[model samples]
Target: MAKFSVVVVFLLLSPFIDGLRFLVVGGTGRVGGSAGAYLCRLSRAEGYDPSDVTLILGGRSSSSYEASKARISSKLIALGLAVPSIEFLMVDLDTPIVPLTATIESCSPTILIHTAGPFQQRTDPNLLKSAIALNIPYVDVCDEPSLCSKSKALSSTVPAIVGAGIWPGTSAIMATEAVHHLRKFENSGDISFPCDDETIDLSFYTAGTGNAGATIVSATFLLLCQKALTFSNGKKAEIEPWIGSRSVDFGGDVQTKTVRLLDNPDVFTLQSSLSSPNISSRFATSPELWNLLFGAMKTSIPKFILEDKNLMQRLAVFSLPVIRFVDSFVGATNAMRVDVSSKSGNSVTFRVIHDDLEECVGLATASFAYEVLKGMDAGIYYPSDLGEEERKGILERVKKEAVLWDFETSYDK
Candidate 1:
């Protein structure tokens, strides 16, 4: 299963150069490819030589790996950046545990980044577990609650960051900033903002799949079948996904879009970390017809079919032709808005907009990976779990990649 070229060369040469090695699982996919490329670029920017940074793209298909490598090389060339040495490892998530561990061990990565997902159907965090067993620092862009929970359970054994992507990752960081802002304002004045009555609302919008891969589309379909986790008045509740529709103003060119409640892991983590009892995550995609199509799928499609990962993946792949056609006109803009408010009528709003979802997800995940590489305590953590300074650092790093990054505050007497 060890299919990497120059593995021995990397192992023999890496220690002498004080280099950084990243093993990105699902490295050929949209999110993983973007992250891998960003990591190389970031490493170079941080003073590592192009030869000093190594990227091992772990995936099952050599063709995909080749394509991803070419894409990354082209991007680096276009940006006038030196391309790091990249290798491919034949690794498959579906393989048995022992083999998978062996494959990952063969690379001896400094950090492991797991981005391979349609994480909705996975009942276990096998990749995270493998990283833990190997004692490799880990980061993942997981957006699934059960897998995140499973990863969290093993956090004490290893240093890991889960749900470290655009929405769940940066979005959580935004929520934390909002909470901190509100708390600071409260502490500075005589305002009494009770934690129990505070509310956190997350609204997200993307246009035409944001030029993402089928896995993301499949994940969305799977989410449509599940119950959205929300907190109301300090109590947790599960409601039907894609139902409670609301219009959100993303500001700038994104304008106002209609978003519906979606079962995102951020709500759960934010509620716990920020101690905000009322939290909900909502999402929408363009060009309006897509929203209607998703709503119809959520309500009209059978539960079993929607829950079928294979079926969903097939359906997503089948629909990509049409989706790409629509995407051409709609563009690939993505935005997220986090609103934090207290019963006392004080509130903070944070918004992040990116012209490309794939690139933003990569940058966000890379920021987390960058922090983890710098060193953190051994434990699993959500983006909100990061300390104030750490959160600020990640946000600052991501800000450069964002089309819009800003926050506003309002107080009512």
Candidate 2:
């Protein structure tokens, strides 16, 4: 009788599960395409009804939308899964506020994933506001610190997770786990204050990863225009962008690479999420020549041009051809290293390396989407604050697609 009852309950709930829908705002782009593909694969793997769960690839025009559909459909077929109920939602965030909101509302996604970026230098929160009004959970792969902070403020009205991809997302979770281990295992020393004595260092290296489209180029220029932020000695610190350069060993065939400090959302989000008193983050690209050229530009470019969004974006748009050419030499590798230490004399380190940044980013975002599908009471969360179960799930999901993934620890004794 009990088994029959369970079967009956499953039958009743199956339809609700099948109704799940995912709408990717920048679906035609690398990040969005990767995510939409993986989300569809994962949904099927999790036993969700493939026919019921819709994958909406949002694009500005029908041509672009059809292109995205074709791309993701191929990816799904390659993975041995029939493409789910795939469709396109016409959405242009650049559209006027009301129509943009109307288009988003019309999709009626169970959870909206926002990957449209160069999320830098923007003050509008119309999409997020619409998500709030619609009362659906929203997730963003936002890397910009200021914009993340602004979006975070809307947590009271809707369920949201900001900075939910790659460095800012997985890197933050690694830091949190390292700190968690240190607080629980390091008792040899009398250092009881985890918040006052711990330090977290994050390093990232990417070799022409992602689509490197105009948005990526523009965001890169924008980051170069501003100062990098860090938390150290129990306080906040700001340093010149691309100044604190260092060599990072990414292990497992990736070897050592050079990285430089750049502002990332984790620099701000980790301050409140981890008990670590000190935190630092840095990023660098591959192909040494590019760094040299970027270095030369640092001093050669006029300050006004660097600081002006319009000018920098124009420069980025024009430079895409050369950037794409350089990418051939860099080989599309993305790596991250995080070191966490407590004065209690314990420490842990984590390294994640993937040869394909686009797919890896999709995996990371899908991991977060998996968690978002699990209902959360309306609130805002950083990747670092995710519960242990969710963290483990994301880490596991990441390993399935990563080329090299490692976690290590040590004690003072």
Candidate 3:
């Protein structure tokens, strides 16, 4: 059988399930769409009945419903999987919580997956607050540090998971696991592999990723306009975005990309949650021009423009033309590398690469959603907070869709 046939066969033989409803905000968009698809597949794999697992695609308008439905239908047919139950919902986050609340109340989904975000300038957690009020499990692919902090504050009252996307989500998990593995070196007979103190370094390379639309572009602009927060030398310090740089080889010389520091939430979140004092996250993208342009803007643009949220977002909107053009040629291959080093000199590195950024991101989010649905002692939690067993379970699912690299290398990077 061909590779595609094998995948189809696996889907056919997978477990079936019944009675689960997922309301995906921005379901018509990239991240949400990928997530909804993967969640359905994974749910089926876990024995959920396709007919029973309802997916509600919540968008601001129902205009795109037909096109979105068609795309999903095509994908399902290609995979030889039955088309699951799906619904279209019109939702606007701009409205008051009362209306949104009523909307969600009517849908009565088991869980709400909040993926619609530019998150950069957003400080209000109304949507999350609504989830709390509704008493439902909530997850978001939020990358903004301030919003994460704000959402986390409500943990005592509600079950919410923040930064549940690929970078901050799965990347954080990989970092935590690396720490665990490096610590084991202390028991190894080899003294050279000693483990005591450690550092966590995360690097990512995305190719015009996040097909979610202009929100992703705006989010990128927002991060670029802000200072990157990194934990190093037992302190959290803000550094200029797109400054620190390093070249990372993405296995077998497929590509060696230059990654630069960005305002990734995982750096600080992991530092505060984990024992590692030194934690940093850096990112770059294919079609290096985008990085060049961003770097140039950081230095050349007026601080006033960068500081103004609306202005930055507008800039992002304007830059979309060029970004989309470049993205067309760059191709969507997303890769990440996480390194954990102990003070005693032992370290472990884990890397994962995916062919599609949207798919990887969606799958990553879905994996976390799976755990949350399976019943996590919810309050606010990041991937770093997961227990070994839970983390392993999520990883097992993620590894199926990603290229995993866990190996030793010379201490020199």
lDDT of each: 0.85, 0.78, 0.77
Q: Which regions of candidate 3 are displaced past 4 Å?
A: 1-18, 156-158, 187-197, 210-212, 307-322, 409-413
Better of 2 and 3 by TM-score: 2
lDDT for predicted candidate 1 compared with the true structure: 0.85
Show model 1 residue runs off by greater than 4 Å.
1-18, 155-157, 187-196
In order of appearance, the predictions have TM-scores of 0.93, 0.90, 0.88
- Candidate 2 structure quality by residue, lDDT tens digits, 300-378: 8876777777777788879888888877777778888888886766788888898877778888898898776654445
Lowest lDDT sum, 10 consecutive residues, model 2, at: 187-196
lDDT score for residue 330 of model 2: 70
Residue 344's lDDT within candidate 3 is: 57
Pairs that collide, model 3: 15-47, 16-47, 16-48, 17-47, 17-48, 17-49, 18-49, 197-342, 197-343
lDDT of 3 by residue, 1-413 (tens): 33344345435643542368898988887678888888887887766677788889998767666667667767777998878888998888888989888888788887899998777778788888888887777889888888888887785334467888888788888877776666555545332232455678889988885455566776777677788888776777899899889998767434688889998888867875765668788988767777898789888988667677777668777877877787788777788898877665656778888777888888888888877765566477877777777788778888887664555643532
TM-score, structure 2 vs. true? 0.90
After superposition, which runs of candidate 2 have C-alpha atoms over 4 Å from their true positions? 1-18, 187-196, 210-212
In terms of TM-score, the best-performing candidate is 1
- Candidate 1, residue 34: CA error in Å? 0.6
